[model samples]
Target: MDKIRNFCIIAHIDHGKSTLADRLLEHTQTVADRDMQDQLLDSMDLERERGITIKSHAIQMNYRNGGDEYVLNLIDTPGHVDFSYEVSRSIAACEGALLIVDASQGIEAQTISNLYLAMENDLTIIPVLNKIDLPGASPEEVSDEIVDLLGVERDEIIRASGKTGQGVDDILDAIVKRIPAPKGDPEAPLQAMIFDSQYNPFRGVEVIFRVFNGTFKKGDAVKFVNTGRTYNADEIGILKLEQEPQKEIAAGNVGYLISGIKNAREVKVGDTITHVERPCEAVTGFEDVKPMVFAGIYPVDTTEYEELRASMEKLQLNDASLVWEPETSAALGFGFRCGFLGMLHLEIIQERLEREFDMTVITTVPSVQYKAVMTDESIKWVNAPSEMPEPNKCSHIEEPYIKAQIISKSDYIGPIISLCMDKRGILKNQVYLTTDRVELTFDLPLAEIVFDFFDKLKTISRGYASLDYELTGFRQSNMVKLDMMLNGEKVDALSAIVHRDKAYEWGKRLCEKLKELLPRQMFEIAVQASIGTKIIARETVKAMRKNVLAKCYGGDISRKRKLLEKQKKGKKRMRQVGNVEIPQEAFMAVLKLD
Candidate 1:
């Protein structure tokens, strides 16, 4: 136990966390020289392409410092605000954290959030200034910033370059000396906390856990404390980037337990595992995961309904945070209402469904949770835009608000402030990190940021801004459900909740945007956006006036005019063409906002 260390790396986006992990793996000889892969822990092509860690991964390494053999367990975590919950759970399972900061960019909002979480978990955070090999690196200035933020001593902060493999040995040395070994009694009854898990079609559920007491071996009858289901432990092992079978996993060691559960639904992360006969007290972990963003996902072809559900079940084994259930749409046929941690989470799942499961799905507009107050004095929460209550039926609607923290260059502060203000943001405070860098804090509605806010922020800040947000609470706002109609037929999927003040502007912009995307028909399509009975914005797609009189050779010009008049009259009668066959692309037009 004295020679064992459990630690994970935490950082902001693009801060070289994965690079540092590779350096450590190489330093400890965890992966062979030929077998060493870039971002080995990520194990997802999407993660590699996006340059982010979407899921937390656990691995074990054998290290030796001056003949002192030590076993190190490293958990790599995602740096985005959407995956903060996952980061927290990863931190909880560790005794220390490697807080990696980009030397050029310094500490951003996500770095601060991760620092707070590490502090909350009471983990020893060793400040490591990464990316020091960059040409623009400012190690001294970043070190000072770290001191100001975390209040640690000057010399204690480590300066390392994840790219150059510098200070990798020092990092491992610091871990052995600073991070305390796991303390648990091997004589006590079995009590294991399932930190994370992975699902395999052939091998079943492989859970990553840290044992607090007793021992677990292959063929042991283990029971999940919460679900009270007993399953035989088919295998036990440690992850050396690859699962290596172990003789036994005793107290104070981190490893994987292969429970004989076939589906991913059977595995529960943040749950306790104990021996069936020698059960001990269950270890408490995180509360049930609640998805913040909700959207409806339907198969492009109705024949793929069962395949979609089966794919979702298989995907959920890998991502249990993904919440989904059956849903029906009048225009879209049958589908499912899926919940996600954030927009990126929603996108990743949709991508996995298509790329891995080969299922093409149409996703509705992603919406934040809103609290609806009814006329009868009942309060309810809504997720999807379609679930929003009518303005006349609702007493008031409260939208979810978040405390946003933004770090950027001072030169771009003006535009950021303007963008935030336009989104109904209430400025809370501002501070200068350096002469050129600034940190601005605001309380902004989550609804506004759910769409194009991130993209807009990048455009305004020249990609120099980093944002992190947390739900502050619900706030009362002048909110309304903006409904868009196509030729008098309401497209339930196009409906959205917006503030009353900007309803007309949004409505006008959306109608104009849709006008460009929706194809023109024989009958003119009136795309109108309205709040209750009041029409706020409208656009007309003129009917294709076919030259019905083109074949009238050498007749009076009035004959051609009369033929056009007859065609116009026919269009008026055919205005309601059974909801107008809207293309699948038309339904996704809302995703292309101004």
Candidate 2:
């Protein structure tokens, strides 16, 4: 156990975490030269194309130092704020963390938040200045920032470039010297915590876990404490580029377990796995995932509903942060209301469903969860606008609010502040991190940032700003449910809960956007945006006219009138019975509304 060191890499987005990881793997000879590639730990095609890590990857390495062999378990984590929960879980399974900071960018909002999380877990922090090979790299400036953020000595901070493999040996040496080895008793009862999982169609669900105590052997009878289900361990192994099967994995090691459990819900992340005969106490579990965004996902064809549900179940096994339940919409038919960490997470899930499962789905407009208090003091959680009660029956509505932390150049502070204020943000505080860099704090509605706020911030800041936010509890707000009506029927899929002040303007913009996306029909279509009894905005899609007088060019006046009357009646009848086929583009129009 003294030669075993477990640690994870944590950083802000695009800070060279994965690149550094590749260099480490190469130096340790953990992966063969023929197998090595950039961002090697990022196994997903979506991750590689987008240049982001959507999932946490765990791998083991064997490194020798001064005649002594050492085992290193490195878990690479996502840098995006949406996957912070993944980082948290990775942090929990390790004894130390490598805090990587981009030399040119210095410290950003996500870096600070992830640092705090590491501190809370009491993990040893090793500060490393990455990307020093960049022409814009400011190693000295970034070194000082890391010192101030972590309060570590100047000499302790390692300057390395993940691209050119500089200082890779030093990083390995530091891990062996600085990070403490995992401490556990092999004699104790089996107690391993499942940190991550993925589904295998041929075998079953594969569970990746970190063993804190006892031993797990192949063919051992194991049980999940949370689910109270037992199964024979079909195979046990340590995670590598490929899962290397082992007869047994002892305490203080990270490995995988397969028991032919076909059901996804049978293996829960953070649940304790123990031997059935001599089970240990269930270990304390990690906090539950708190999804920031809620949206409905439905099959394009109603007949594929069961297939969609099956696909979601398999996907959830891979992404434990995703949550969902069955729901129905008047316009979109039966669907599932799925919860996600943020809009980016929602998009990735939707795309993965299409690419991996070949499941075509329609995602409704995203919204934040709100609490509605009734006149009788009953509290109800409203995840969708359709769930909101009537204004008279509800005492007040409490919407989710977040404490937003933004780090950016001081030059763009004015525009940033204006954008936040426009989103109903209240400036809480501001501080100067350096001569030109500033950190601003604001209290804003979660719903405000659910749409184009991130895109606008990136545009205004010239991609120099980084944001991280946490829920600060619900607050009473003047909220109203804005409904969109096509013709005369209210489309529940397009409903949104908005602040009273912005409802009218938002409704107007949305109505206009729908008008542009919805195709013209044979009959006139009325696009109306309303709040309860009041019609806030409206637009008309005129009916396509085919001249009935073309056949009667020189007919009598009575004959022409009769043709016109017949056309009018036909249009009215068509309008009454015809169902508008809302194109998929129209469902996502709210996201593009300017």
Candidate 3:
């Protein structure tokens, strides 16, 4: 147990966390040269293409120092704020964290937040200045920032370049020396916490867990404390680049268990796995994930509803943070109301569903969960715009608020502040971390940042700003459900709840966007945005005329008028029965209507 050091790498996005991890793997010889690759821990194709870690990956490394050998369990965590849940799960299973900061970029918002998270969990933090290979690398300045942030000695901060494999040995040495070994009793009854999981179609659900006590042997009957379900472990193994099968994995070790459990829902992340016969007290698990954005995900072909559900369940096993329940929409038919960490999270899930499961889905306009207080003083939760109660019935509405932390250079502070202000963000505090780097805090509606806010911030700051946010609780706001109507009928999928002050303008923009996206039909399509019965904005897509008067080229004025009247009557009838088939892009257009 003393030789087993479990740790994770935490950093802001694109801070060389994965690259540093690859070097560590190489230095330790955990992965052979023939098998080596950049971001080696990031196994998914999506992760590699996007140059982001969407999931936390754990692998065991064997390090030899002097005559002794040590086992290192390293979890490479995602750096994006949307995948912070992945980082938290990794943190929960580890005893320490490698806080990697970009030498040139210094410290950013996500770095500070992730560090706080590790600190909260009592994990030892080893600060490392990465990306020193860059021409702009400023190790001295970044080291000072690290010292001020972590209060660590100057020499304690290791300067490393992941690209050139510099200081990789020092990082390994630090992990062995600084991070404490896991503490658990082998004699105690089995108590293991499942930190992460992945779906295997041929082999059933594979559970990756850390053993806190006792031993997990092949063929041991294990019970999930949360679900009260028991299954025989068909195979038990330690994780390497591949699963190294083992007869048993003892306490203080991380390993995988394949129980031949076909159902994904049966296995839950953060659930405690114990021996069914001699079970120890259930271990405490990680906190439940709080989903920040809600959207309805429906099958493009409605007949594939059940298949989509299965795909979602399997996906949920891999991504435990995804939350969903069955829902039906007037336009989209039956679907699941899925909740995600943020817009990026939502988009990734949608893309993965398409790529991995071969299930094409249409996602509705995303919305934040709202609190609607009734006149009788009862509060109702609204996850969709369609769920919002009438203004007459509700006393007031409260939208989810977030404490947003944005770190950026001083030169862009003015534009950053204005951008946040445009999103109805109230500046709460601002501090100069240094002469050039500034950290600003704002209290903003979660819905305000749901769409284009991050993109706009990146544009305004010229990609220099980093943002991290946490829910601050619900606050009273003058918000209304803005409904989009096509051909006089409301499309529930097109509706969104917006602040009252911006509803008219938002409605106008939305109507214009739909006008551009919706295909023209035989009849004039009236695109209207409404609040209750009041139409706030409207746009018209003119009907496609067939030149009905071509056959009567020299007709009298009265005859022309008669033919025109006939054509008008036909248009009115077509408009009544016409169902505007909203193209998929229209649903996403609401996000870019600005």
Instruction: Give the candidate number with the greatest lDDT.
Output: 2
Error of 3 at 227 (Å): 0.5
C-alpha positional error of residue 552 in candidate 1 after TM-score superposition, expressed in Å: 1.4
Q: Provide the clash count, candidate 3.
A: 0
Superposed on all Cα atoms, the candidates' RMSDs to the truth, in angstroms, are 1.8, 1.0, 1.0
Model 3 lDDT per residue over 269-377, tens place: 9899999899777777479999999999999999999999999999999999999999999899999999999989998999899999999999999999999999999
Runs off by more than 4 Å, candidate 3 = none
Model 1 ranges off by over 4 Å:
556-562, 569-573
Per-prediction TM-score, please?
Answer: 0.96, 0.99, 0.99
lDDT (CA) for every model shown? 0.86, 0.94, 0.93
Model 2, range 1-594, lDDT digits (tens) per residue?
898999999999999999999999999999999998999999999999999999999999999999999999999999999999999999989999999999999999999999999999899999999999899999998888888888999999998999899989989999999999999998899999999999999999999999999988999999999999999999999988999999999899999998898988787889999999999998884898999999999999999999999899999989989999999998889999999999899999999999999999999999999999999999999998889999999999999999999999999999999999999999999999999999999999999999889989999999999999999999999999999999989999998999999999999999898888889999999999999989999999889999989888775899999989999999999999987889999889887788
Give the deviation of candidate 2 from the true structure as CA RMSD: 1.0
**C-alpha lDDT of residue 213 in model 1:** 84
